[model samples]
Target: MPHPTGPRVRLRAGTRLRTTLALVLLAATLTVGAVGVVGVVATTSTAAEAPRTWVVDAVDDTSGNRWDSVDTGTSVVTIRVGDTVEWQFDRATQGHDLVSLAPSQPWETVWPTALQEYRDAGGPSVTYTFDQPGTYRYECSLHGPLMTGTIVVVPADSTNQPPTADPVVEPLTGPAPLVVHATANASDPDGDEVVVAWELGTGGAPTYTDHTMVEYTTPGTYVVRLRVSDSRGGLHVEEFPVTVTGTGGPGTDPPTDGALPAIDALAAPAQGTAPLAVAFSTQVTTRGEVHPYSVGLDDYPSIAGEAVLVRSRGRTHTTLSVTGTKPSARHGSVHVHEQACDDELGGAHFRLDTTQPFAEPNEIWPLFTSDASGASGLVEVTKAVRAGPQAVSVVVHDPDNAARRIGCADLAPGTADLTYSWAFGDGTTATGADPDHTYATPGTYTATVTVAHASGEHAGHATVSDAVTVVVGAAATSTPSPTPVPVVDGTPPRISRVGPVRTVRTSRPVVTARVRDAASVVSKKAIVIRVDGRRATKVRWDRARGIVRWRPAKALAPGRHVVRLVATDAAGNRAARRWRFVVRLR
Candidate 1:
């Protein structure tokens, strides 16, 4: 084995003393007699030596805590060779790993030398062997001062066994303060296995098998305790009190405590370039309660005007108003904020916005600008009550954010009765209870409406009328019947090509033909045209114009071809036309 035999390699006093102590401690055996190691009794009460596991916490690396155990430096551990040392990186700010550095100890150094590679791939920890007996020293690479741990690798023949673990109780107040975490610090004196569990109550109630920590979702108080056991059922238990208090639960009945104010609805002006009205409602649960609010468009801030507090009988309500100047990019959400609350220190919040260039299916869509009950700020052009020319109505409601519409603003508190109408283009007119319209002619025309409200001088004309495009249904034209020629001798007719075809392209292919209907000239239904004895597919017809076309099954060879045409009209007459012509291919 390699040995350190040169001149007394003197290290700094601090470094040398620390290194000497570490080496001596590593060589020292834990089996040595100790005053505290006496009179320790082993019990089998089913709760004394339960095995408890802590996620190898990585936080111990920088917390000045060894082995990332708890908030403490000393860590108690026991395992056989090849056993894993799990290091949990739970909230640990430093990245660290284990290394075994000891003079003249090759095997011990083997694991630590390769620790760098393993440290990169953090995990519970790497396994090691006890083949060569000795001690191990390791430290965190990221934060050296904060992280350090030692392991005493004992052979299978140690005389002094593990010491009996003392029961440690951490006292608390009441309601069993939330037990976010729980672990057993007990161990077996005989190196026996430990199994940890919780003893719910007396009379030996069934204990929990998996040691999962429990938590409370609500604020409360309770009696909570922990129990530990050894392999032989020896047990130990401790009870502690805890209390929980914080933000209350979700509001159930119209928060009698904290309430925000409301705002009114305003519409953008008719001018193409004008600001939009900030339509928000307000409310307050208590007086002297000032709630700050602001509005904005597309990330641009808008003045939220001023907040006015008012008293209603015994309660309180505030009104907020704001406006948006500038033509916003079509279709976007407006943001509204509820600054603070009276009763609740943590003020609540919400948003208010509108859509741009809204459209409707088949009607004179309206330009909406108002705040009404049930409608919010959603504007639509619906069908009218009476029908003459097309009629449309535009309805707006409070922009109900969060689907919450309590005592915010009574747009139409009970029933939203506010409605307006508009007339579509075309002389045809109609009136109804809905906001919809229909056109009389099939043309693109500008339709306009003048809306008048029942309450207040809420009247406005949408001169920038919506466009209406009416479509006419397809109609069939009349066809003149061809007079049939008298038959003399029954002879098959011949069909020959005349003028050049428009082109070989499918979009526009035109071929002319001369047809001499043999026996009797007949107006026909079915026509069969064959190219080289094969029938053509996808034939088109224009009965009134006496024009018919036969798109070839496939492009013909650039040569001459023989073609045949046969037809049978409604009458019991048939004709066959056969001809030959030079074929063209492109």
Candidate 2:
């Protein structure tokens, strides 16, 4: 019997395994014909040449995991439009699905339009063809952002170009139960047939035509995206923001000086009176080591920036213009707060309206993304700055998960001198900027910083706090759970001295490898064999001798062959190795 983690269990030589429940029909139809699988197309051309197929592998859950970088397992490939890319998920222990993230939008994610998703009963291999040329970003829904891959599709023919989409969203802002209409007027330079699709960012199905009507019942900001594709494989994307106010909340609405949602309806709300030329900067550090193990902690560690704001006392608005270099193409949310870089970073959203809910209508959120040179342009949010101690900091948050603050910067203080205190997660406290908290125990910890602006112009009334979770090692088990994988075993098993290398004289070759873990190896048949990327069955494992062997169901072909073996430990840590061997003439 084959293990659940092995590549989709092979049946006979010609037949494949597929399930109706796990298949995704949004992108294309799945009809497993007699020859094989097909679903890719290209732009115009009589002699366009045959469409080539590309193969990409999904990192299995029992393998090295999503934490491993590219060369370890993750794949980033560049291809032409209409080319078919097949993704293999045979050893998918976690049952993963591939979904796209409206690549251009920062604070919004639409349920990926995919071909086939691997459920417990889904097919082992799924294929998708790029009908349009665009940079597509996708990730496994089960694993988070770290388990991600990118596909850059270019035009098959240069003369035939991609189309451009001009997305016009009407009534961009309004009260609760706001109804909005979004349309895309797209054109291709080559006068080719165009297909338009709109993703409403509401987790609902997308509209097929060039125009669609959507209703926004929620209060927060939503980014709607439009994709334009030409028959010749040229594609383009355009994004717009739509803000809907809540029925009622805590604060009042700031002035409409900066009422429009930033570039993509991401996070830009401006309300304030005058200008207070104050400037400050800070580096963007990823504080994402939460207990549950949030993804993308190390993705944007070096992304840094600063902001210049208008600060004053007793005003009902604040203007924040972001001016700095952020080298990352990915974006996060930015907000201005009353406190200067304390726990919660810049304090809560500096809201002038105490009755409105926590949203853009009453708060100041400026959104920005940089180019290749790290230039993030200007972002302004209008509101009354309380001068000195209040409204003096800007913080950037993760676009998908706001709890993760990726970057922060403080404003130039006016007459208020502040002191700082730090509390490391491991029961240790310190004064000033003490960077001496050495990490020994492997666990998840959230460090906090408190700022004090007492004794001067702002007495003891100006104390604030901010915290960013800095995760170390794996997901620690602080609380009790059914399975304690991270809490119990943190190390993966070790495999050494694999055999079946060079040339073998016999038609039946014996493959051998030694796999052992500090803890006991729980996998009864931990060894999985693959020949040239295709999963092979009938391979037997001899645990008594610590070696797995494989011979042909028939006779071996006389030539070079490659074998890939992946072994999983009791704790689910996986190791993989690939070796080549040859069968010669007798």
Candidate 3:
């Protein structure tokens, strides 16, 4: 369903990187194609050392002091030629892709040389062999810097193997003041001794040790790093993420305590009204602390505004009254999600079908723009009364990059009494109990309304909708498309001549052809005659009957000679004829 004239939200994931899949298939060794199942640990080929397989898991948590979107564990992996590197996709909660990058090149130089990879959870295992020995850089095509790493491939030999590092932490998540014991099980494949050092990742100097205990005093997130260095100057780093919860202190809820100061239902349509009109209104504030997973710290400036959502029936006839999210007039995506502000990307878009296709008609999208002040906004939507929990929070996306979420607001429940949606029939729509629209063209249209009670007598109840016939009496006109030009078939003059096979008694031979066209008249200037592959100097022509005669410039000394005639008409069409005569010396 498309609305040619209706207001629609631009739901852009902002990751247009999927289009580069073609480039990935062309230059990549293993990418998306012929889907199948492979072992969790598989080798491309076997030779001397059985080609050990390195498992690089998908790390998608923001427990680290710094948020790196979806990363392939181990910032750097050292491998030998012919060995396999397997990228696991089971842990990627959100869509993540692996793409090769040109490390020396700048950001603008992406795609043509970038490796393209697409693998969803439970799809398949992605792996590639390093047939060539060198350093190769790769990163997530969508997340870029936030999810990047390096791969070092050397000649396969009894080289000093880099120590493999994996951190074992007691608890990954728990309450505040939690004491955590961590150990790095590291060993070199070449049986070489390695040294280990631990850094709290939050800040401070590295502590030299094999295992240590750290005390967590606040509720937040932390990451501990363990770098194991081999005596051969080869080192690899591994990170361990930990979550620290507070006892309802400042560390737990720093930004407004995840609450909206004011919430109101601006509409109240009576029960039994099929098409109900309602608007859920509330105040939203953008706090950097609210959304931590954002790529940048200051993606959204601090601002506040009242957000209102108006909804009608089946198709969301949505109207967002809350505007002025920023200092200037610009648009961004605002979607109603099912979870709280705690989940990544607000869990997911609150959808009704919860299946294959997901977009506009399937989900509720509220749009907002900065009126003048550079701050907050909200969206309006239409759903059943039971949609209260599903429509918990509103997520605002960056105006320039829709994938980077800038702000999130948890909507207080039971705020709106009735919601409304209206279809003006001319492919246009309106939301809110009282909506006004102006039609430009004169035509009969079927206007419709869908309404639902949000709270009170019908909390989490069903919805009703009604339609009515509408007619506009004004006159309108339209111009038809222009016709194409026709071709002049068989209009060019034809060169016709009749000749008998004869041995020329004389050295010079003459040839002639006539030019005639029933559709058009032919002119003498349009006729050309040639003798022996050269233009005939002594030529005879008849204008009235359209005839031409041509002879060689000199006496014919060859065994055979050819004479040609061509005639052309005003329609840019031409015709030609050729004849040959034999010249013999007596």
- Model 1 agreement with the true structure over 235-307: per-residue lDDT tens digits: 3333332333332211111222222222111111111111211111111111121112222222223211112
For residues 1-586, what per-residue lDDT tens digits would candidate 3 score against the true structure?
1111111112113211100000001111343324543222233433355565566765554321111212222445555555656777665554455657663411112222344555544545567655544555566533323355555554544334456665576676688788888787777666778777776644566677889888877544466655666766445555555656542211112123222222112222111122323222211111111232354236444322223232322222232333223466554456766555564446556554432223455567766556454433323455542232244556666565454566665554322244566776779877764455555565555566666554455544655555444445444228664675874666677665433135644353345455656456667677777766777665666654344655444556848777777778777688888777776643
Q: lDDT per prediction?
A: 0.30, 0.47, 0.48
- lDDT (0-100) at residue 220 of candidate 1? 28
Residue-wise C-alpha lDDT for candidate 2, range 30-146, written one tens digit per residue? 322222555423334222554555566654432222312222122444445455566665444333445554534322323234432433223456566655545655655333322
RMSD of each: 31.8, 28.7, 30.3
Best model per TM-score: 3
Count of backbone clashes, every candidate in sequence? 72, 41, 25
Candidate 3 or 2, higher lDDT: 3
Candidate 3 residue 434 C-alpha distance from true site, Å:
33
**Candidates' TM-scores?**
0.18, 0.25, 0.33
* Consecutive 10-residue window with the lowest summed lDDT within model 2: 262-271
The CA lDDT at 270 in model 3 is: 16
